[model samples]
Target: MKHIKRFIALFFIAAVLSGCKEDMVTVSYPEYTKAFRNPMKGFREYFGPGEDKIRAEYPYPYGSMTKEYMQWNMIEDDSSDGIDKIIAYSNHRWKGVEDINMKVILRVLLVWVEPWHGGKAKDPNNPDDLNGWHWPKGISPQVSPYKQIPGSVGAYVDPKDKTTPIIGGYFDPAFPERVAKLVEKIGQAWDNDPRVAYVEMGIIGEWGEHHDPDLSTYWPPHDEPEHVANRTWVPGMEKVLGDAFTKAFKNKKVMVRYAYEFKDYEFGIYWDSWSQPQEQVRGYEEMKKLGDRWKTQPIGGEITWNWGDLAKFKSFEQVVADKHTREYTIEQIRNLHCNHLGGITWANFNDPEFRKNAEILQKAMGYRFILSDFTYPSEIKNEKPLNISFKVVNTGSSPFYYNWPVEVSLLDAKTHQKVWSKTLDNVNISDWMPGDDWTIEKEAYQKPAPINEIKSSISIDKSLPDGEYIIALSVLDPAGMLPSLRFANENYFEGGYHPMGYIGVNKKPGKAMIDKSLFYDIQSDKTLRYNLNNN
Candidate 1:
């Protein structure tokens, strides 16, 4: 009996040892995490380094010149109190708009509503130099203005303007109404009354500078604390102005500017008054309400705030932290959840340093803003010997330098086949100054067998079989010769759109044909010469 018991105990011990060994045994598992990668990091890896690096195929003259329009620059000087400077600037901007296939623009500085002397174009109704009435002014010398409201002509107005020169506020009563009148007069001057791209006021001025400190001052019978507690402007300012402007322009999208910039992968936010985040929220809320009515928009600007400027700070750590604070402030503003969130404007165009910051920030932020007109050419046509000419304009506030490669293709109208192909390389365009116009001219094949080069008018070759043909053009921005991502984006500016032009043919020709002249009369009409025999 004792031996049997001992045997059972031995068997139990062996089973326990086997179980421990099994628990300690190593097991094999896949090494990969199998998680998704970040999209931004992926984009960076794919594109390599720097901004505005896009690969595009540039086609030539046979393709239409997509960006064949022109531009004019007009600067407003603060020193000149007389309207002469303003008038001259306006005329210079519109110098050839009426005679060209382009749009007219008048750029000006947004300052306070102050008195000014009138020039030759005086108001016939108010003969007492009514144009000199005190106008709305912008706070802070830092805000950079780019957009305009339809009613104010091309000028941006501040909601806070007064008759006196106070530190932070405007002195004008009914400031909103005054701005509306300004917009109306300006629009009438351009024959487009009350311009629609209405006033984009910058939110950087010190709180309670232009008007009273309490919300009750602007909004009569101010009773609601909900509207008063953290309001930027008085309770009713935006409501009244937004309503009036919307009624007149019939368009929503009121412009509200914010200081926005990106540094070291983070966004920086600053207002005219860094002390009043609550007031800033009030202003943002007003604009948000307006945007809710139709489509609200937030126009972000890259105001000048350099960490290098803050070198006096105790340590580089503090300076970097401050810079980071600015970026975080903007992120907080975006979190406010307003509609029509407009893109950022990288302030002064002439500064190269500003461009560098804009480039990186635009990529990191995933936001977009317009750079006016930046498209390549679209269509090109020829008779026998052909010459093509077009213009490119830098509508943004900076210069654009890039090599344009042009390709010319002749298509068969009947069979839809390519008969001739030629690519022009290393076409260098000198500095395209902001708001300045530049032209491009090229001459291609000159064989005029089917038509006479002189007697026949300029027309596309129609001598291939009975089929439709088109000439196309594209551009490759390998060197990143354009502006930052904001200006170079395909969605924001036409500057990056490839394959902009095309030409078509119908049948074989038997007569002399003339080339299309690039000349335009004062009325802005095209002069075309063609041969009936080719058709």
Candidate 2:
């Protein structure tokens, strides 16, 4: 009997040790495959007026653009309209933008210069040339009492008769006040609009570029001495527009043409001559001096190949095609931390080589969120908190400017359809930032990208049936509450969501048998209004 008691004691001790060993064993989480490019950050395609004709032609993701000529006259032609016209116009222009999962960068312009070459007849009534004088009726150019330069000719020559001189409307004393009032009206119309991504402070200069012959430092004074006084910025004009935009746009980010122009305000830059070698002094260097400003504000622009040293490239394609030029262009993009660029709107994306190189440039521009790791319990109890943790690394140059919501969902195990979803309110996705201080020599950021570990305790619905479910995650665009920003992960479903692993309610999950064939393509899924394809 005593021998039997000794054996029982030994067996009990062994059983206790086995139980502790099982409890202490670490739970293994599945590794997520990293993806390259995602949405809402790279390559803003140029969009113009026209509803049915305009389509997102690119494949990568986001379709966005800086739209010129939210012209003063087009929005509110008369003061008597009391901003009603602008509100109606904006509402019409952005009618289906959000539903299509697109964003527009807008600028209210006062002047647009028609593309002119010597000896070409200019038409003042050309609707296509939304250029020329855009100021509303009753407002006229205020001529200076004294000649700006003793015998100098005024800023502009009549388009029809080149010999006739005309003063630029920027000289009008009432222009600033009118612009301020107009800007306020624009804010009333667009500040809260979800379709609008950014507002460029573009009331001044031509094409809203903030550089007219009268206001540009880069453009040389006219060869004739008479045009010298015309090549200068309006005095105190910066403060007037700067203060107006600062006060008007509390929600939307505002971008200026130059970083130096709006020094006092925390405005972003829309450098028109981005990556042009000749613009190193006025453009590249000036923006580089801002240091980490790109973290908070966007740095975006177009790469124009028609002017200055850019002419050496001959064309946009040649610039991206040449190995040397392409590398330099990407270096500049990384150095300045650019978010989006224009000028590629016309590029032949069908060409394999051009598309390949373009993708490289696109990947380098904006936030590229990579899901490195994801963890959740193998079995989740009903009416209990399902704890989940994940790590994201932004491998790209810039941060996502907006704070969109992150969602955790459970997919039907057999069908792979989303069964339940909950937006994680605690996650501030915008804070998941990329590395900084890019080094051209190594072709890497000086600082290594930091990992963002997000932890969330989601409540499993008590009424949910006890069965296995595939767990997934997705970032919502907020405009449509649809999964818009895709994770750079190989585990992505055809829809925007990323499938992580499997979980069970009230039971251990069976082996995950993922059927890629069962997944529905986001493009064909009419139920989902957000179309992934350009069409």
Candidate 3:
């Protein structure tokens, strides 16, 4: 009797997973292989249309763009020959843009300006139009005319022809080693160039966004003392431009348009006045003393009333047209921890309700992981070892600064290919920030301690191969480890490779086929509904 029908199907799955560990939910699900959207995360394009048409018009999974490239005559001519044509036009505008894996967000403007509220330093009927550089008029490194250079131009000492008090152009005195050798040739040509995601630490002033390009000639200037010079918001030059963009981006992400005075260096705060609800809570109290430097830096910004009112917004006719102006722009993108914004040069994509109020705040921006519960062991033995348990939660707001590599693979089930892989390497996910004990807000909250109980035990790279395979999970992006992240879950498959069930490779091929699809039965353990913006 075939071993009593295999002990009645292993005692009917250990009595349906220990029958009701107090109502243990289990509603038949075992079938998957489709749910993918990983690229990088929302709204970032100022010069759009390509990157798969802005990820098919915003599926928000990577595809950013930026390019300032004036680098002050290639940083006063130490010229790394325009840093290899700006990394060969950023690797030829993302050569074959890997199905939306493009990246870029580079911003190298070593000072800029044109009619900067004050102009005519030249170009009067083309007095060789700026090709005859004469920067001394209203200094602020706000001089450009395409990095002037005729006669190797230089003749503008007029601070009223100083008897000894010159303070002009790029504030001479070896301008911080010419902006630290252009931040060491931009970390020797785009650090970790997996096309790079964020960079904007552009050597000061205009469009770089970090204040003081003579901040409108010192307006309310009496907080007095920014390393004295009667303050132009320059105290310790934000640790010399946050230690030169934390030593030239150790793997992308630098930001810095604001957060007023680089809150003591863990940089990653930007906000070009997008819906100023109290300057977005004073930019979250300017990083309330840095506690959670938005976990590994990256807040993102741009949108001071443009992008056509965020793509002609509607959120159900602004909940009767005026709901506190879309709840003060969704509480500044859910409490100012935005992860990329300013899509296609300020929203309003020919208005279609800007992707429906950007899917109601891109489902709360920044992190969004879900994968409620997962357990493995459907039969494996091709040089194997597999023990998994996942319950991930961080529903998004911030957290995911790097520690990016969390694999698991096995494909072939009908030629999907892959087969076996690993890489959990003690997963940390940058302490998985965000929280969800639930709270529309009323302070003194403390419930956010539970939901994140991720446990793992993966390994399966053994030599022999035998049969069925289709299990997936990936998080990689350590500058192109591939599997780009985007797991709010639906059992992803395509590029992000998520699948999550079906295995029977070399041995233990008897039982086990558990996979709670939309999490069935519903007994107790559930809380991983990662919102889902446009599914």
Candidate 4:
């Protein structure tokens, strides 16, 4: 009986010892944790970076651009997770948009509401007079007298008085010449800037609204003959301003407030009649005729009133008079096919409930990319080309307009230093727009039918020492030459780059190739006591 009991205990011990596990990474359980991609899109905040856009604190308020507020270094950010983008009024020049690496919507304010001072034939200013505005660098001391709203144009009663230095009206005969000259200057400054996302040909009405504010709409209402005539659109006024902006911003997306007004030019639409019947003022029917225009250019603007009260303001006049406003719902946002929503209160939207609402809109805005899947080898031979097959689907309403540079990098496993980097030249991300259309009954939208498959490859240089290295991916700006964009994945690196996965360098990473003489050379460095001291 004693011998049988001992045999049972020995058998149990052997069974337990045989069940030990090893820490090796298997194909099913890869070393890297699978992180799901977040489908958050960015909101174009004019005041500052809003809470919904960056997933954090909203930035302090900043006002729109004026002639006086043309260029300056950015106010040092007091908070973490800095600003992303700004919708700016151009003073015929680009500010420090690139310095902060912020994307910009450039609105060329050719005629502010006052009265036109000159026309298209106006010559460019003298070189000495071009001081780039009130730069603290001590340029010319000419200060702009342009004022803020309420009195932006109403304050100017006389049409002939140019001595006081007022703004411009659309019907001013020389207005086209003046705007054309300003457009030329604008092209010289910011047309090709990668930071400039869209340039609104906002050279017509009050604040470049592209509308002739007659007595019915102009605030502090005026029907004076001079004011009426000054606000009227002449035969080619629209053509002049539209054509000028189109030519000026040759490399950027140019937009017009009213779709039909600038019918002569090829440009996008920045609809201000948000939440209202798009056709109430203009832009709906004509823009609708532009089927799939969103694929190439952007369609965006600020909502007129509270999104909840979509019927409150069907016209520009009502939007200006409404005492209150609210945010738009995902359905309302999708209805207009808007790429970005503006003029909404950013600070008030931080509440958990409101944030949840904003999250829905954020996903609906701009381009929300998702890395559906990627296929690459875990093991790659040195000096051989590495091919990474991946797919990206833009789950947003609009496409990413820029053809940014897509690059692949091999990094040192431990240090994460760059070993070899190469760009994927043929990948056209602009063509990857997965249109988001809502199925209201289902409470979810159907994403674009197609997933863009990119089978991009890069050759590893033979000079790079083989060892275990990590592979990464990034889209860089050619100007700043830095990672200018973030991928949709959860694995974001420090400078907006994303980690695709790991790659094994020469068979045995750090142990691969080293001359014995190099090891001995390190020993002599220890004889440095005198030099190590306070020399």
lDDT of each: 0.27, 0.69, 0.52, 0.50
- Cα lDDT tens digits, model 4, 367-435, are 666764666656577677676777776666677777877888876666656667888988987787765
lDDT of 1 by residue, 1-535 (tens): 9999999999999989875431111111111111111101100111111222323321110111111101111122232224344445445433432221122212122322222111123245532222221223442222221124444423232434221122222223444454455434333333331111123322112211122223233332122222222232344443443344344432322233332211111111112222124444544444333322211232322222332233344432232235454354334333332111111221232355543433333322222112222122122224443333323332222222222334434544333345664444433422332221112121111221121011112344444444334332223222222111112212211222211123433332332111213111211112111121222
For residue 408, give model 2's deviation from the true position in Å. Answer: 0.6
**Which candidate do you rate higher for lDDT, 1 or 2?**
2
Candidates in order, TM-scores: namely 0.32, 0.82, 0.32, 0.64
For candidate 2, lDDT tens digit of each residue in 107-152? Answer: 7776665222111222455433354556776578533222223243
Candidate with better TM-score, 2 vs 3: 2
What is the per-residue lDDT of model 3 for residues 375-456, given as tens digits with 9 covering 90 to 100? 6766656555677767676666666666777888877665565756777877787677775323445421144523666666
Q: Determine the C-alpha RMSD for candidate 4 after optimal superposition of all C-alphas.
A: 15.5
Pitting candidate 3 against candidate 4, the one with the higher TM-score is 4
Winner by lDDT: 2
Q: Model 1: runs farther than 4 Å from truth?
A: 1-89, 92-180, 189-198, 201-240, 251-253, 256-298, 301-357, 364-497, 500-535
Q: What lDDT does candidate 4 reach at residue 470?
A: 63
Error of 4 at 166 (Å): 15
Model 3, CA-based lDDT: 0.52
Candidates ranked by TM-score? 2, 4, 3, 1
* Candidate 4 structure, TM-score to reference: 0.64
